[model samples]
Target chain A: MMPIAITDPDDPRIEPYRAVRERDLVGRQHRFIVEGEVVLRVLLQQSRFDIESLLLAENRIDSLSNALENLPPNVPVYTANRQVMDAIVGFPIHRGILAMARRAPLPPVEDFLATLPQEALIVGLVGLANHDNVGGIFRNAAAFGAQGILLDQESCDPLYRKAVRVSVGGALIVPFTRVASANAMVRALQGASFEILAFSPAGQEILSQVKPARRTALLLGAEGPGLPPDLLAQTRTVSIPMSGGFDSLNVATTSGIALHHLKSQRS
Target chain B: MMPIAITDPDDPRIEPYRAVRERDLVGRQHRFIVEGEVVLRVLLQQSRFDIESLLLAENRIDSLSNALENLPPNVPVYTANRQVMDAIVGFPIHRGILAMARRAPLPPVEDFLATLPQEALIVGLVGLANHDNVGGIFRNAAAFGAQGILLDQESCDPLYRKAVRVSVGGALIVPFTRVASANAMVRALQGASFEILAFSPAGQEILSQVKPARRTALLLGAEGPGLPPDLLAQTRTVSIPMSGGFDSLNVATTSGIALHHLKSQRS
Candidate 1:
């Protein structure tokens, strides 16, 4: 694919990349931005999302040549000097590489669950409004081989720019769907014969001692509020043994530890 | 203690809190700033560091009255309206609470290690320059009851403002010291009879299978470069089992998992 040079910051061809940060506040309109060389590579090589175009700093073009060559010719590669690139993005483009991709329509929750293997490990996130936490959990989920993920309506989008970057592109790899509420998520998982395990500080079972069933779902909530009382009461709740007064483990880190234990515990 | 009102942004008495973001580029001269109600409560309640003063938006003063009652009269509490506070700090202080504290001199590495209990768990960080990662790791270390932390020369300061905030006061609660290099940190831990376990993608032992000694130190490096080869060769290396082409777990998440596993495996 020949790299096209973009000289003007207001170039209409790159409208989607303009005022990137401000646009993040409103919605991406079924489109999302991926930044840096690592995530850009994942978008081109492995992501299920369709690549709309790439905006790269002049300096990044040479290094990205090998990866760019494999792109389908239909995908346009746009290049801009540092000044224009920064002006277009409305921020200093430190990573110097950004890609805009079309987000695939989210699959229905029941269909996503039905597709999972008989013995599967899944993750459910409720009221986790932080993108970093959602992203980090997806990273852990992918690392530990969790088959799928479910997010409640209140949780932040994992495809947000920072979350995707923090996950190191794990959001692109994980298959996930959103549900109406925490209760809805639990009902779907239980209907699929998946054992639901929610993490809470007041959890009755210690994380180390709990043996998960073949099909299991690990549920997590925001740091301060944690998993809600109703959800915790409904599921087999588990807790990591913490020091006397310190119960604040970043929710993402909590997921990483819990997922690792569950993955290793399977016979 | 009465709260002193300051209307001007350039008040010399509130100098330490001025242009907070820019000042972070330079050093704080043996002082650090903590933010928000939760961390403020921790600073006043449990921290060994001495309070220098506090800067609060007028609205926060009432909520913080209970915490301020116990403060030493010598420590000043300054309050300003939101506009003045924003101008003084060169940004909107969303949490509207800030505290400046004097940093006690970091004890010598060996002397600090000598103070730990006979059975201790410590975390050693190398080349982790990100504030969020450092803070998240400290949160994990504290949650899992790791008694102390050691940072190599290349690692970022755990006391950096963003790190301190991300740690949820773990940076203040956990005692940490910096060493000359990764090798120096490993040598000190080994000298103190800590069976050092360095995490690497190319590690020899699975993290789940490794039984830790009574005096254990979990060594972690930045996500990409990981631990230096020489340091990895010297220490008993371990790795979390990752999925087939995906080995990227955030450095902080990795530390959380490794520390939790080691802590649980102990008697």
Candidate 2:
């Protein structure tokens, strides 16, 4: 289980991982950093993504030996001491493991829609830019059997490092693609014969009253100002009935509740 | 709506709001910090609590005139320049609003229960060390009309600064009490004639199939290691049916699903 040893902090081999906080924000070459052992394992197992390389702190290599077995010899594994690891990453490296991963773009929205079965459950996001919220929604969508997720261009990147980790790597496994706008996203789902349900505090129809359709999409918006008036007017509005005068639930929490209600595979 | 001007950062009048990030962590006395203008307005309007004072950044003062009209003349309002505010708060003070408020200790758990109606809904938490989870649960509880929230000894304080802000003031409004341990919390709920349903991934019954009871409590645990096996044994178990082979949703997200399903009010 020998790994390539890098004694110098400035080694060119580990350049992708330098100053992770800022460098990741820059996000070059269609590749992203993956943190922690859980997300790394997902990247290794998911065929759609390729691992560029792996960097592990010297102390963590022995513990992660079993996990490294499946790595093809072609995938370089670089090991660095604590000092070099910290110097390379601009911060204290607590997780002690990192991987550079690149994902091929998912199928076009139309092709993705064509692949889903008739009795599909999908989640659509509009104007959501928070990484944690995007990640949390993807995680919930996976837990409740969502066939796919659709996002507007304004939606934050699901492959962003923080979003991927927060999702527990659900983003890596779950299928999702972003459209031009929420209006177009809704239109595409409707065109595919999916019943689009826009959720809002003012929604007239109660959740329990509406029956799940063969093809369904739960549309959610960012917190504060919810779905646009034009969008809400065009779709069937379903509200999760709440105590009078209380603020709406957090968007991710709202998605979880909505997904649980319309789950087609509830056994 | 004139406010008292604070020319110096070291003024004792705004002492409660000084060195806020660290001072808030220390949490001297019974008071807690509330940030953001929206939360500040909630503090002003909530009759259940008392305001010790207010500290507003100079630029934000004019915008908040209408909100300050109801404040009694005796309540001190301190206004400071942005630089002074930033220095005093140990951060940039972006939200530009802060409040000092205090609450008398809540009625003991038994007396609080005695006030509840026969059909009250409650949420019980065990070993939740994350403040965000605790606060997010309270927000969901409030939205769903839960009458009370119960926490075990290990759960973090809901009034902690980050928790309070994350909750969007739901923690200020929702009634909660802490018990000795998970066992004692369960016993108290059961003794009060509330049906205690512990949520677990391995539970036999699906979420929607379980009928909401007149008086019910949904029990949740920390994210990684869930409710203790002994606790799960004593109570009926309910599971949010998931797509097989995916990770469990975030603890906060899970609570939202369970709470929505068990929501007693449908109107």
Give model 2's DockQ, 2 decimals: 0.76
Q: What docking class should model 1 receive?
A: medium
Off by over 4 Å in 1: A8-12, B7-12
TM-score of chain B of 2: 0.94
Q: Second chain of candidate 1: TM-score?
A: 0.96
Writing each residue's lDDT as its tens digit, candidate 2 over B1-267 gives: 568999888888888877877776677568888889877876776535788888898889888898898787888888888898898888998988998888558666677777888988888889988988988887888788788888888988888888878877778777888788888887777778988888999876777888777888889989889999999999999888777677788888988888887772333
What i-RMS does every model get? 1.1, 1.5
Off by over 4 Å in 2: A264-267, B264-267
Clashes of 1: 0
Give the Cα-based TM-score of candidate 2 against the true structure: 0.95
